[model samples]
Target: MEFDYTMTTIKPFDVAVLAVEEEIVKAGMRVLYVHDVQKSLVEKGFQRDQFKIVEFCNAKYANEFLNADIKIGLCMPCKINVYVKDGEAFISGMRPIVLSQFFPHADLGEMPKEIDQIIRNIIDNAK
Candidate 1:
């Protein structure tokens, strides 16, 4: 199974990105970083435009999971990136289920479902 999923066909890339960020914050997650990719690339070495990545995380959830297994720091953080492609804004995130699979003995039984739903809600609201 794939770890990443994408939402396509969104209009006004900037608005869509903001909507997703709002939804994520409303769902009790913290916006850790919002990178304007175009500017970042230009700062680095690319000429791309209208691209951004929003990194988010819920402290409560992250702490709980981390306390359960310290080694899970390999995937300690979670993020969702919003970017433009073909003139449309799209959101993408890593599937928690796949990430959890990396630690089979960690007992992430209900956590994956909860995380997935939170991500889905953010994506749905973005649209």
Candidate 2:
């Protein structure tokens, strides 16, 4: 029943962020941009740990998957939340397969599985 996957690392939050980014690139994807959710929370008068979101994508994967069904574009650019908790850094995100099921295009060959595996591997390696 588990859908999202998360990994904890003794490394600091910034280090964990770099780890996730490195894994994504090693898999041949590009890290789109990082968002600091913690900063926004702090602006709201709430102190929080490092809570950033890292998004990445692979052009080759996207082109092929869209050929199968462009609707999959809605889920383009996989995202992972890089955060700190209890002095430990953690990366968490939904498995692409979990979201793919929402659309009928979930069974479009191995493309979905390919994307899922890449992102999952990124999270795992980040740990």
Cα RMSDs of all predictions?
1.7, 2.0
Best-matching candidate per lDDT: 2
Best by TM-score: 1
lDDT of 2 by residue, 26-86 (tens): 9898999999999999999999988999988888887876777677788777789998888
Clashes of each: 0, 0
Query: Over the stretch 12-103, how does candidate 1's per-residue lDDT look in tens digits?
Result: 87778888888988999888888887997898888885777788888778887887788877774777777776666678888787756787
Clashing pairs in 1: none
Model 1 score (lDDT)? 0.79
Segments in model 1 whose C-alpha atoms lie over 4 Å from true places: none
The Cα local distance difference test for each model comes to: 0.79, 0.81
TM-score of 1: 0.87
